[model samples]
Target chain A: MNKWEDNKAWFLILPVFIIVAFSAVIPLMTVVNYSVQDIFGPGQRFFIGIEWFKEVLSDGRLHEALWRQLLFSGLVLLIEMPLGIGIALLMPKKGWGSSACLVILALPLLIPWNVIGTIWIIFTRPDIGLFGAAINTLGLPFDHTASPFDAWVTVMLMEVWHWTPLVALLAYAGLRAIPEVYYQAAKIDGASSWAIFRYIQLPKMRGVLTIALLLRFMDSFLIYAEPFVLTGGGPGNSTTFLSIYLVKVAVGQFDLGPAAAFSLIYFLIVLLFCWLFYQALQAVGTGDKQ
Target chain B: MARIDLNEIRHSYKPSPKSDDDFALKRVHTTWEDGGAYALLGPSGCGKTTMLNIISGLLKPSHGQILYDGVDVSAMQPEERNIAQVFQFPVLYDTMTVYDNLAFPLRNRNVPASEVDARVRRIAETLELTNDLGKRAAGLSADAKQKISLGRGLVRSDVAAILFDEPLTVIDPHLKWELRRKLKEIHKEFGLTMIYVTHDQVEAMTFADKIVVMYEGEIVQTGTPEELFERPEHVFVGYFIGSPGMGFLECTLEGDIAHVNGAAIPLEPGYGVRASSLGSRFKLGIRPMYLGVHSSREACGELPGFEARVVGVEDQGFCRIVTVQFGGQEIKARINDGHPVAEGLCWLTFPPEKTKLYFNERLVG
Candidate 1:
């Protein structure tokens, strides 16, 4: 039997394509156009053909900022992933206590990034802040604006405090979705608590942990507001990460071509690292299957 | 292996259970012999799972001791007790290989690597998972995954008993048979005390040497499959054990005869004396297979029978289940395909020897 078929169903995706074109494609194309041309003003421009890319790629400051960004992302994942999972594990399974803990954990995440930085700045002020005053009172020289080490510490603390809750929430959800029977089976199988966590809990949380890892990695890689407001990339560029450094190039020096080229490289780097993390996580889950 | 005893065990989910109804398991007082296969047979929420968990040391009874080999283990953790359990669904570690999943129990107990490998391999071979031992457990089919879950239990040779809580519910019908057969073979080979929990009567009958029938949180009866069918200790056992179950009619006893709505049905001698001494009205219970259905009074011949209206006839391929309204109550009667069946009106003969008397939902001795 021949059935009547209409090709009009294909048109349903047109709206999505239109939205994506305006939201991502157009902006990306403009950035690409700016990266390849030298513009002195609104109407005067010359196609430079890869010169900006070469210049951005070879800049020593960009390389240093790239290294710094990599280190920051690495530390964020290293600290946040385990810390988040640990907190989630320690959280109450159910009851008013569980809800209370969840609300408290979400408090840091709900604060705006720049507001979090300001809160931390006041929290760590040497003259008036709790942490800064306490450290100086203890005979330690603590000033985020004066010392690079102090600035890096203050920025790292703010970043971890502001974002660890996201990872914790994801891990908590993963932990909760596991069926109770696994724990029962493990207990009856004579598994120790640590073994149960390693075999049952950890493996079951793989999907959410993968998401958490990638999200935290990308978010930390693109971090700007909190660190910028907290230290303003001060103390001699100690905390001038890739995003902060890029903002300096684009808005501070107003180097449109180089900044556009830098933005494209940054996007590629984030995409590449996320892909690598996802593949690694999936391989661990699938074992020798693929 | 150990003989597990539930010494008057009772449990309640409520914090302060003041009455019997508040208890999930009102009372479960029975002993499971060592090296014996037993099934906790019951409908859902009949305390079968509660009993199984108590025996496995997963749930502590609210009142009473759980004894393993004459030692109290009521307060012990599941891991502290030498037991293994499989849940209704397969609970294999998703990221581990089949071999690793099987070896996990032994490894956690600090078993030597060489011994763990040998035991894991042997169990895998027994479960016919030797070929797939290196594959991750998550990629396996549901039946294969269940086999892995069973293998994890089987790998530990020193387990006091292995409890299965409807482990075949997740398997396909064809695979269920194979897996059940494997379990029976494992039980026979190991001689491990096994307690299986299921609401499926056929599964209970075939898998267990003894069936503990539960009803409304009480152990109504415990007996061999034949005893459960032929001499049910409780009305519930008679009702729950058979294919088309037992038919019950409210009646009063009078000198080896049971009167149901002015109709008298003969019973075995001494029932009248015993039921009278007990001094209460009782019920007449008979299995569907034994309740003979005839077309006419002449067909009943020398034996007395009651008149009933044929409500429906269901053909079950090999036999027919005749539903009849007898004495203002609906009851079923099973007839062979070769037997002549009546339409609209029929006579039901309760064979004197096959009939049972029940007093207050319990068998009259």
Candidate 2:
């Protein structure tokens, strides 16, 4: 009676395997094939062993962009996490007010990425837009099109506004999942507001916060559309992230071998960091036994 | 160490209650003395939990005052009231150690670290949680988590009261008995005024010095367990506090004689005036244990006897419950273990003084 008799379960997973093999595996193999070959034309090629890998690894431009990418992602996580939690806490808990607040707060996330960039471009025009004019009226020179610092600040502001809502929505869901008895018990025990937030609310939100961190990291690492539309790699490549630099190498210069090699390295870097983050989060969440 | 007085308390879930049905709790005026253990017993949705919450300052009564030691605290916050409560489900900080969980209340009040440590350890030792003090609270089982929840309440020496809201519903049955005994011992040792809320009659009877019986959001009786079982003020109290409960029969009383289906049983002469004023709704309640079964020839025949048909007999080891039909109704009779289950015709007698006459569900004088 204990012997396994169900072969039908295997058929249910076959579609997922086929789709992944075609979409991810096959294209990955093609990149691997291109990275190892020195192609002169469509039909002419020569086997080059690890030449492109070593050359791409030594490139100075890639190193600068990688460092810039790390800084941008780090800064994005730092600003968005706490801001999102604060917004979630401020939202109403019940009645029609809660629904109205949710609808208004979710408006920014629904806007397309390129549209967000376009909106910010017109919204900070210095002479015509309110944001730039207000800052200039305060006697501060604020033109995003000219200075590198101004350009970086505008881009950071746009990014924070565009994605903070996602983190806030996730945290709101986490807060709602806690039982009401915890708060009642905490109140009767004479716990202050800060202690309740630190112990009860924050610890309960760890699972969703982990998701928010991973999502914002992976999305910001691979960011392309918003910054591209806003800065266009800048007057001196001041705001050029890794993807922008990679696009310049792959499509602008069309150096097929080194570009393919760089693409594989970039993919591996993101994958390795994501794996490490998952491990660290799981370790903290599970905690330690006595 | 406080005497709690609730004066004319009424609560309604609606903004303006049109009738008594909208009120979750009717007007309740009662006092719990210092160092006394009391149980508020009722069925679900009977406002027992609402009463406990109002007393602990988690809720404020709509139109009344709560006084502790002659000081009005109805408008005060829960923290200002200096009370502790244990919920039905265990509520513990999942990341803290058991010792930290016990010390949470004291630490929040800015107790020194040394004193917090001493009190936490002392309570832990008393609750048999010393071995698990260093372990994560989240890693313990449900019963252990509940123990830590209770220990948090006991760590504070100056607390006015500790209220428990069905703290043992999630525990194993055998452990529930063990924890109940431990609670009794703690009550004796510390003399803390404790109020417990539960739906189980046995739990209320075993753990409380006084039992407050509530039904349909009304306080029906407040008495000792023996008083509640013997002289139940309302029909609900008699049915709610016993194993099989008292059996009630519809009857018409005219001049001290209660006529049940065609046979008449005499009651005390004082009931004659009250029974004449009663409407058509009247009943006579008698406990199952008082109803005796006898053969026709063996009775001395002073009491009223009726030929009853045996419907069913349930043998409950030490005792047996005999279900019979008489006077157009069914009543349960408890007999000794070896009592023969006689089928067909059997004479059933209800002793005169043990029988109680009810007018509008209230016992008569």
Candidate 3:
């Protein structure tokens, strides 16, 4: 009777299991299959056990793309976290002004990723684009299509603009969740502005900030459409992030086996970093427990 | 410690308050002597918190001044006023150790390290938090955290006063007794001016030497607990101050006698003359404890007892409250556990000395 009851519990989960297998497990299995075989044509594949993995891991282009991807994500986190928190702190705590500010902040986030790229592409143009024409008017020789540095700057700006609001919104929610009494108590305790921020506001914001950090890290680490649309692996591949490089390997070069292996490695790296980041943040306020 | 004086303080949150109804605090004119324990007792939105905030300098009143030691400190900040406030919820630096949490206010004022340490240790010990001093404050129980918050308030000796805004609301019921006793001890030992705000009559009666009762943004009465119970200045006070509260009967004054329904209940010697000037319409207020319930006509004896139909009897462990229909209203009379309780009909006695008369919600005589 107990065995039957346990089996009945598993039966209830059959729908979820089937959905996961079809949507996730099956696609992942295809990737794993592709990663292990050397495909010449349809039905003409040979088992190549770890050869593709070895080749993909050792590729000089992949290593450069990996370094570039790390730097980009690191910069995004470094810039956005503080900027987002600062903006949230400056945002009005209540009233119509607060609502207006929230709407304005959400505008960039509402734009489609591809559209953001297209908008930035024109927006950073030297002649017709407002930002580009204004910058060029200062005679700085600003042109993203030609300069790798300019392309990086433009891409970073667009990424920051597109996603910083998410961080700010999260931080704002965290701020609002704090009871008004904490501030009242802090004022009575003679806490200075900096002390209030450090002891009360910052510690309270840790939960949402950790979420913001992990999300920004994972999303930026696997970023694709914006840069691909804006720079398109660019003039000499300066702006080519890991996702763009993976696409080049899979579609541009038609190296399915290598691309599959590279993708698995990419997923592992993001998973590893996200785990490390979450662990680091979670351990922060706890400090040394006795 | 400093004597806190609130001089005609009135406040409104609107940009320009044009009417009396717009104000949260209509008018508060009172002085709290230094080192006296006081509680602002009122229901929610009675402006008790607003009064506390105004005194602590957290809020600037729309009109009038707050004086600490007879010096106007209304324009100053809460920190500048040197006041400590414990909130309804425990407010501690979550990441800090209990010792650090206690030492925070002192440290912020640049108190010497040694003094801070000593004060923190003394407060932690007083609050029964010595062992938890090394633990992060966030990990402690709610009661322990509240102790830490109180410790922070007490750490600085220079603070003018410690204001508590329903600090025990979040505390466990069992722990609330211990914490309230601790506060009482602290108040007596330090002789610091402490103003506690609470809606609970028991908390106000026990923690404070004097209770300031408020209703609808007005200070109806300020007196010792005994005085408030014995002579409630307002109808709201009589209703709010006691468990089961005071029962009021509408009556008309006829010389020294009060006519209610068909019964003629006499008042105290000179009360009828006082009632005649106050107004003809009056209410006789009697505490359930004072109202006498008799099971038999013989028990009524020589007292001026009136006949009433018994409505219901409630056995409350230590005592029984007999609900009876007197005139047209239901009135409760508290009797001792072993006291004989009448079933259908009974006689109720309202002693002239114990009962009070009211006119227009104001105490008449």
Candidate 4:
């Protein structure tokens, strides 16, 4: 008993821990090192003493990208959450039809992110795409190719189509987890349709909805592939969210120091928001318990 | 309160019930008096729950009408029918407080806030849940949650009837008795038209003023507990209603004398005609508690006793259950603790009036 139990059980998990530390911790350490230093080449470096952080914070591009990212995440969450819940409600509760509906809804989520971007890019072309042709035929000078407003609409629509399924799937699982007894009780209570939704369905979906919101928000904020392929940050940086802008600075302009600092700031913002979301969820759970 | 009538309710899931087997609930016609407590009691998959669901409007009959107070409301939804239902499992909203769970139905109907508060408090007190009123339902124990479910159904008194579908299944064994007693008190106080469905005979017998015994999609019998005990209309009812149920042994009847394994037994006159129509498949049913055991042939000749081999003896504190094998058959005899009969050989007797005769799975009068 005093031999510390050998603890071989932890040895079984050592490989996983090592892999995660290498993938996440090592790169994070590299980013931190770069953020604090001025790098001249692969082998040469100098202490910058937070100068790059000051420069990155003062930059106007960072502000613009931050605002755009926030707006996109907010809009995506607002549109997807309720739309997903509504679709889930309309889906059949049982039988072969329910499986068919689930399969159809799950089709969009199966496609790769880059493929989704490519598909939307081709599907929204002015001359060749059905949507673009229909809009042009309606005599509205709609050209996502050259217009910032049109580009933003195209990206938003693509994001909604690609991500709304996730929320819907989560909501569907939540709805299915509810035992039929609750519905029977509601019926016996003589609850109106609205009252049942308000008092029973909504409260039951709280846990899953929190997860859906957080997932959709984080994904929308960090979205790159779809918008990158669709707009390429075109129409003078109108659709340039923070992820796209950070990539442009690090890879395009080759300013690793500022880019690393900017990346750390971006990570902090996400961390702060996620922490806030988690805190809010805990509060709701505690309040419910009381 | 209203008298509800199920008029020739014959329900089938498919387009047609081609054979008798296809009907989940065969034709059932019954009447529940106003402010009367009734129980639909049956074994699992016996169509008792199907009948209850039909009455609750969760399922519509393939043919026939459900009338409430002489008015047909067959096409109405459950809400339109104005009934309360408690399900097998607790169905309270886990996110709401115990008080709010009880107040939900009242608030849904837009009851006055003061009345809602008073009613919720009263129900909570009755359920012994006043201390848990402010606590959310999720963290409550299973019995507490079930009590909340029962309270929710009972909160609204304006409903036409309160239907309970095995509501005590999740309740603890010790608490089940308490809740059953509380339910009886509530029934007497409010005099609501209540329909309880359970497979448990004790719950049914203790709770219902009138019990409807159902088996294999048909209403075999409907009567008070005593009526069910004394005169079971069907062999299934006789076997289903009592503990250790009714023991069935093969027997043949001819001219007022019943023969079991060639052993002649006397029967009341005129029971011969009813037994004669029954083909070779005939049986005698008697409750175990009504059986008497003897140590020797001393009481055998005068009391119409039969010789049997004792297979086992169970000491039940107040009494002993002696499992006896006789005439290539097994029977249970419940005897007072003072009686002593060895395991291998014994004598048993069935009081003539207490014995029930069955022909082709039905009781012969």
Displacement of the residue B290 alpha carbon in candidate 3, Å: 2.3
Model 3 bad stretches (over 4 Å): A1-8, B14-21, B295-302, B337-339
**Per-residue alpha-carbon lDDT of candidate 3 for residues A1-290, written as tens digits (9 for 90 to 100):** 35433457888899999999999999988999999999999999999999999998899999999999999999999999999999999999999999999999999988999999999989999989989999999888889999999999999999999999999999999999998889988898889999989998999999999999999999999999999999897878898999999999899999999999998999899999989988898888787566
TM-scores of the candidates are: 0.97, 0.96, 0.94, 0.95
What TM-score does chain B get in every candidate? 0.96, 0.96, 0.96, 0.93
Sort all candidates by lDDT, best to worst.
3, 1, 2, 4
What's the count of clashing pairs in each model shown? 0, 0, 0, 0
User: lDDT for each of the candidates?
Assistant: 0.90, 0.88, 0.91, 0.88
Candidates 1 onward: DockQ, in order: 0.65, 0.68, 0.66, 0.62
The candidates score, on chain A by TM-score, as follows 0.97, 0.93, 0.96, 0.94
Residues B45-146, candidate 1, lDDT per residue (tens digit)?
999888889888888889999999999998899888889988888899888888888998898889999999999988888889999988988999988998
Please provide, for model 2 over B246-344, each residue's C-alpha lDDT reduced to its tens digit, 9 standing for 90 to 100. Answer: 888889887888888987877767788866766766788888888878757366277767777878888888888888888889888888747577766
Model 4 C-alpha lDDT per residue in residues A204-243, reported as the tens digit of each score: 8989999998898889989998888888887799999999
Chain B alone, candidate 3, TM-score of 0.96
Report the CA-based lDDT of candidate 4 relative to the real structure.
0.88
Candidate 4 TM-score versus the reference? 0.95
Q: At residue B153, what lDDT does model 4 achieve?
A: 87
If chain B of candidate 2 is superposed on the true chain B, what is its TM-score?
0.96
lDDT of 3 by residue, B187-247 (tens): 9988999999999999999899999999989999999999899998888999998878998
lDDT of 1 by residue, A1-290 (tens): 88899899879998999999999999999999999999999899999999999999999999998998898889888989999999999999999999999999999988888898899999999999999999999999999999988888888888888888889999999999999888888888778788889988899899999999999999999999988998888878889999999999999999999999999999999999999999999888876752
lDDT of 4 at B74: 97
Using TM-score as the measure, name the better of candidate 1 and candidate 3.
Answer: 1
